[model samples]
Target: MVGRELYRLLQCPTCNSRDLAVYAEYVLCAGCRNQYPIHKGYIDLMPRQTEFDYISKYVSEEESMGEELDYREMAPPLLAAGVRHRQIRRMLELKPTDIVFDNACGNGRFGLWNADAVGLLVGSDPAVLFADQALAEMELAQADSRRLPFVDGAFDKSLSVDVLEHFPRDVIHDYLVETARVLKVGGRVAIFSNTREMSPIQPIINISKRLGKFFVKQGVYDFEREARRKSDHIKDLKTWDDVEAALVEAGLKPVKVVFWNSVFTSFVEHVLMKLGESLIAKRRTAKAASATVLTDEAVNASAGAQREIVARRAMRRHLTKSSPIYWALYTITLLMELDLWLFGWMRTGPYFVLAEKVEGRYVPAPLPAEE
Candidate 1:
């Protein structure tokens, strides 16, 4: 289980050289004499920490939060994980012989979960701390999205899910260029990202926030802060036109675009999310008040117990047939399915862009057929 496939596929990030040989504890690049360590069964290919401060900070915070919250899980009752995964599979058209790359692959769930379907799957992220689970399934490396560590035309397909939103506006073009650089001709790149437009349920969400403010005054909840923290977007792509232009600038030819997650579904998902947060907060507050003195062990024990409770609650919410949360999620998923079928062409929530790398200018290759 030496991950020989990855050894053959990856290049030295420092020199863009493929003269790599696997040592017992590291990969040695004969061209540049740079040795990258293999820690916890995954390669550390990041040349330096030049552009990953935000990712480092965010991953540190998320690690401290423990395993109670799953970062990959989408908001319940809207945009279910299963639904999204299905859409991704269709968009990428993954094949048994395809070699795929996941850039900015936070947590690496998309590639890890689909390991059986593809020949060689590789996931890279600036934040390597959250990559343990993904490493178990595919070859993972801590590498920058703006400077991918693979040689040119190494991959048959590439994907970036909910990752571009975190990139600064100025560097997005560079990121896309790096993504295109690593893909083989006819290889497609699929991106799911948020734009500047508010979800269709902004008015309802505003009214709900106003009502939630009264709860805050009564010392019952802080829904507004919770919502704001979750909805924070670092970079804004203004519109679909902007997204397309960026891809084109990076030598990618856009082929398809679709907007999904309807207004009604998003509104309901937020309401449920706020309610869940309030409930968890209340429980934590009660536990804090009941404990007269707190020690590190006591705090850890309390957290462990809370995680168990939350996991059980989530299981019931998603699995139990009679549970209201389960039914609500099912009904919303069905409705959203219908919405996509009927009006997905209209501009709405976040959109997915499918594009292919422009090969002629960069390297000679036959033109890809239209989708």
Candidate 2:
């Protein structure tokens, strides 16, 4: 099991020393005399929280709503998330004997889903809690990605999703350095995050967003609420070239690059699915005894719990295997994947990338120009 050699991979985030003492209650750092508390199933390795300029929703919102939401019932590799996760898995090219790290592993969504397929999974994030299923299947840690508490060349491979947007150029290179530092030589890491540019199919996305706003005009997907959520948090707006340059600087050579958030994903998720969820939330509000509609902020704040309830129900239907709805969803997911095939070559919007750790300098390969 991964536990047998887990300490071999871990180090002190403060002092970067591997002289750690593991105990029933905590892991003690010999160099810094810092004790990391082991609770619920994850080690808290977040550095001085005050130094952080941006706070993740996982740290702020999810922590408060933890009591009402059972992470064990949550599904990560389903619906829209599944689209990104599928591409990530393909980029990772996982192996049964490889030790993998899920960096920025929010709620262990991908880790929990792919745990059985790999030898071991170590999910780390700043503040997100792990599901019971993940605790049973993988090691969970609360660590900052920029300063991971892991020894150099610790993992065979890693995957990070939705992390690049939060890291500005000033900080993102540090994160990439840490990422490359933890991977073994020639080891590959899968990355899924966005650039600042518009997608090749931006017009289609415009149409989809407009359709959703016009038809499902509801509190759940309000524009102002979304702006409030993303305006500050998504500060990393570098171009693909800038990101690739940084990756090379960190000794990680990008081997494969494919983009997402195009025609299929935008229409299916932004328009169709949002439309359905908005309608459902509206009906639920109307059926309330007081018949009071929630404010936009309330709708956004409670979205996690609401979606989980729906996910749990869908999980039951999926477990049936014979249910027609299960196949319906399966088919829709497959259909969504068509966007990857259609738009993968185009360098635009969010992307899934596979990069390997190399010793020498890495030269950038020019992707086919979109023009």
Candidate 3:
């Protein structure tokens, strides 16, 4: 039954045809006669030619970088993918029978975390490594977000976290339109992304980055790769109003908007990150200088040990009844929560927009007349 349902949702990317049949390990489209292979439990639906050269390069880099880090350990508690997933679940009122689509699901963290709660979870990403990671828990496909291969109205909800900003400015609207096309009428979509308004803590972060660079010169830090990672944000959204306008133009009705991660929380998290990275760098430098041979297993065990120590410290801090720092952080968090409840639409840190697809044929917004 599940396999039949999955078959029904798939369509030919070239022809947008539903005349599809499942062969041994390929989905064949009778309309275009295109055969898409199923590899490692994921259907490869990526089109042969992409609209932009940058898209392919970006996806390739993402896949290559996937082998470098353990995202679960590096993610901070304040802005973790789990944190975003919980917010999406609450905002969309996700139910056990809900069919959810996670568009541009890099690493598939959100989908994997909530797969057990939803009836069907499908994750689509251009990066094949992300699909490979998600295949254990949910149906995954290697496809562009702007050209999803699913049938219209196939999903009950769609969620995208920190994905829109990576797209070129010219194609963001197309991505939203595709998001609406795959969702059922009145189905909700949630998007979380960084805005153009720099958070109050951003200046401090910049200062820290400079300090980090200086430390690198002194052999106390190494952040050259991290510095290069910042170039991925090709399209930082300017404002929440712009986001809402894009959704409305794409045939989705805006439902709820909220901002979170206040200045205080961000500052604290930055400090923690800097401290952790410095310690790790120091250890690596010492090991290298001493010519100490460390096996991959040993290195992984050390990282795991460090993560456990940090987790224990975090737990103890939260549990401590009379600690001043704990109370201060708690208060700051409460204020941020209140700010979201009171003034989410106003410019703040990262913001979320929840919208529902409107019924009717979606007419693309007309291009502006020539001056």
Candidate 4:
């Protein structure tokens, strides 16, 4: 991907000053005199050189242990994709010429999805692996999300998907403030996260996580397996309240926080996770016994089988018995879908909460009721 025009998108990460001068790869902050250097076409915007614990733990250059793990084959949550992309496109409706930032952009997939609408797309992540993944998909600069290498209020739109949970609760406020700082006045941001009250699957997933960790402790699993299965730097499990509070504290106007619900999202997520667990187990044993180099085709085949297993589990969950809480959650989710259908939002999405930033404050609007 070609880098967007430097003059239009460059900003001082610390002071948010437009008085930035760029030469080759270095951007100088006129206000603070802080120097942000560019390396390999990506800028380093961190405040100080400190180790990113999460990146160190989760992203590493090692072969994945396929044993006792299976979530790899699952497609991203369909509902999430629809809602997130729709919100991104909608930001265009709010402001067509906004510079957009995808914070902690894992692989540049979201940036690619929204590439056409935004005036310019900037994706930043601390992990080199994520940057590599993003670069593989499209040209993106390597930078830190916390200390962005752009001017204050330079961007008209920003987004972070499933990223806040990775930080400790105390520091999440700082992240939001930084997000607000980078956004232009009256800019909008879309945040997608998993809330504790949002679904019952959190507990189930947590239990599975513990079980997987137990296996690792017993020497049945390895580091790669753990990294692939669980995140290391995630410090908080946010609920709707926490999300709203963070947004408010950050000084961005909260327009809406819509709860999202869709069969595709839930189904794809559930099935893929089940399969990931299975594949991890299978790979562990298969690799140990075989001395031959593993081919991409072989890995894909393993992932495909795991996908099938996830699909099967999804069907079973919908048809078979579950806990009372699950039934309640399912019923509520179904109701949310029905509401979406009545309002003609299902094709686009449901459970979306929209927010707008006005006068350095977030103003949230109540979710539209089913028509």
lDDT of 3 by residue, 1-371 (tens): 02455677888787888898888788888987888888765788876444654563447666334433333222222333434666777787888999999998766777777777889888888876553346655688878877789999999998998887776554687788899999998899988887677554456446645655565577653433343344577554476666777788789899887776344334434344455545644555544523321322223333333332333334434534476755654554554355355545556548888899998777767422322
Best by TM-score: 2
- The number of residue pairs in model 1 that clash at the backbone is 0
- State the lDDT of candidate 1 residue by residue for 276-351, as single tens digits: 6456545655555335213222233344334334433444445556667677667766655654565567675577
* Root-mean-square deviation of every model: 6.3, 5.4, 6.1, 10.5
TM-score of 1: 0.76
For model 4, where is the 10-residue window of minimal lDDT? 289-298
**Model 2 misplaced stretches (Cα beyond 4 Å):** 48-57, 60-72, 218-232, 278-320, 360-371
Q: Runs in model 3 with CA error above 4 Å?
A: 1-4, 49-56, 67-79, 131-133, 199-226, 280-345, 367-371
Name model 4 segments beyond 4 Å from true: 1-4, 12-21, 25-41, 49-83, 87-96, 130-139, 198-230, 233-237, 261-264, 272-352, 360-371
Once fitted onto the true fold, the runs of candidate 1 whose alpha carbons sit more than 4 angstroms away are 48-56, 59-79, 199-232, 273-332, 363-371
lDDT of each: 0.66, 0.71, 0.66, 0.53
TM of each candidate vs. truth: 0.76, 0.83, 0.76, 0.60
Provide the lDDT at 208 for model 4. 46
Q: Report, for all candidates in order, the number of backbone clashes.
A: 0, 0, 0, 40
Pairwise TM-score winner, candidates 1 and 2: 2
Cα lDDT, model 4, residue 53: 43
Better of 1 and 2 by lDDT: 2
